[model samples]
Target: MTRDRVPHILILGGGYVGMYTALGLQKKLRRGQARITVVDPRSYMTYQPFLPEASAGALEPRHVVVPLRRVLRKCDVITGRITSIAHGDKAVTIEPEAGEPYQLEYDILVVALGSIPRTLPIPGLADNGIGFKQVEEAIALRNHVLDRLDIAASTTDEDVRRRALTFVFVGGGFAGAEALGELENMAQYARRYYPQIGAKDMRWVLVDAADRILPEVGDEMGVYTVEELSKRGIEIRLKTFLESCVDGHVVLSKGKPFDADTIVWTAGVKANPVLADSDLPIDDRGRVSCAATMRVAGLDDAWAAGDNAAVPDLTDDDPDALCAPNAQHAVRQAKLLAKNIAATLNGGQPKEYRHKYVGSVASLGLYKGVAHVYGVKVKGFPAWFMHRTYHMSKMPTFNRKARVLVDWTMALLFRREVVTLGRMRMPREEFRRAATPKRSQRDGSN
Candidate 1:
């Protein structure tokens, strides 16, 4: 039971809430009073809302992610996945690459391990579908889409070309809709270089189980978004689910089977599965249960927030109402949680987390978008402008902000980069083939 000289705070996950919460703690606490450590699988925090634009060549991939090491200089950053949380012992088990499981004790723990892609047991999903959650996934998807176009342009087989040109996106939320829109826009522009392939030749389908898309925005704006996307020849399939996607052959609940080389899954997200392994109190959805103050119920010096924690929504009267898992709530919750943690450590009363839902904005390709900001509805170019402006203001650090702005500026003057390096996804495949021994000595031996 030997204790470290300085009190340690272990923050899990380097997402929107985790990074900001650690930053707040470092800035508030004295240099020597407390030590902070952040553990996440990624070495950087991705500003996820900018992912669509980044995938479409509107923003640099690097600019959309903030390096955890460079940003959190005051805190210890561990690049590893948190396997389990031992709340009773105030410790966490981390599994880093090429290492034995190690436990790290903390006086305070912030469970900010964010949500993962909510996947279903639908046939062929695991084999054929790719998620749009991480930076690597985004980059891979961009390259894959462009590479598909290249394949289609060079191939003479109609079936192969059709499959390559056809792109299917499941989930019509912000992630699915925006990604489909931006990539479609980029692919359309790319078709100009290929004399054979035109925008009409490419098929883009967006499928969602919900009746309405972009539920974050109001119904009016959602309708406007659907209209704009439909006008661009992008098919929107509502109240539909992907029944199966076996070997790229997709069968929807309401449509005929179609083969697509690119299938992106962005339907929704659920809390991290790690929560279920811990002794901490969790809700029915496998999210850690926490009060409005962001403290895990019946736990001492432990708090949870972000997508993984089901924080009670004080603003809503429904007993079952919980904060929606979004960046808006995560950012606000992080600030409050940081202050609360700091206060608890310094013998002060912690504050409760509360914030009004402002609104949402979604970019629908180049100059099209839909937004509902503070009950004021905006559509078309105005909404698009607002989407960019809002995200630019929220993007982490001045460096990333400047880099993203520069990316946009260059995009305006130059053609979007359409080149794709699909081989990057499996860079070692060639080596694997080359290393394999071939049968050669049969002439003399046989």
Candidate 2:
């Protein structure tokens, strides 16, 4: 390498860690210190915390995502997948969406590929179960739920109506609970528009293998979450597994098999398995082993964090404890990671990453929530308000923050929009139907 050549820093993902790290680096580094390049499959970074509200029509989907090219003006953004990484050669194979794979060399590599859904081999789950991770999934779930209401309202068959109105959510974690809370609230509100469907007609059930839900919040808050959902006529099933959902026939371990039209899977996530192919040191959970400094263990030029890396939890007494996979930790780690990289490039020492756990807050519905922060507990409206206030402040750009604020203000002034563009799923269906000829035309009767 020539002394005149600037160092190329490659970021593997444009998620919470990747995007924020680039944002920080672009600000912290000198004008000619390093050239930054961020590679991600999608062009935008999603604010996952706001996904539930967006799904429930309280916010727009586009507002929750920040376009990578627009935000990272100083960085070269590549919409491609990192197929393989050969750190020994300081290069990675990139697979663009429409082209053949190619190799890209860099002086430093940042792995923030994040995690994917941890799924099980339950019968019909692969065919029928829908996950609640990406914005697309959230939008699809909203459309499906509303479409079911339409079906139940129009159907005359009692069994069919019952099945159409039944919505089942598996996994009592943050995603499942929040999604269920918001969507159930939206569904209940939408019911008023349909005179045929009563409050009792629609069924909302939450199933979890563990005995508790929303464990991120506190024990008391978790219990309160269950009770609150119960008050809304939503059933909570704990210490139970989804034995099967063959053809929408939900069979639980301890209950009579019931048929549901919609099934949502929010069961945890696992680290990306591609890290192993890079020959990086990984923990048993498939996460890259990262030091307190957010650098890959035993490697100088490689860095990793977020859900894809097992970062030491310095705030914990347990030596083996790792940071929790959440937006709070990811955002903080990304900022530190950028500074650390810049410090190393400029012959300065990189600092360690450490932070004490503050607590947690979750939105149950519009004005309903639970929060446990700094040893203080708050429930209902106060908690809900805190959830919005805290996340909105943490939300990425001022542009997004203002857009989200406007969305909330408008929502308070008007009723929620209950329209479902379910056709977005299969957009070509209407076109295909319109282009197809009728039997009379086919037979030349007209």
Scored by lDDT, the top model is 2
Candidate 1 TM-score, C-alpha based = 0.96
Measured on C-alpha atoms, candidate 2 has an lDDT of 0.93
lDDT of each: 0.91, 0.93
- Please give each candidate's TM-score: 0.96, 0.97
Model 2 misplaced regions, further than 4 Å = 1-4, 438-446
Runs of candidate 1 with Cα error greater than 4 angstroms are 1-3, 428-446
Alpha carbon lDDT of residue 64, candidate 2? 95
Top TM-score hit: 2
| Model 1 alpha-carbon miss at residue 238, Å | 1.0
Residue 52's lDDT in candidate 2: 98
The digit string of per-residue lDDT tens for model 1 on 34-62 reads 88999999899999999999888888898
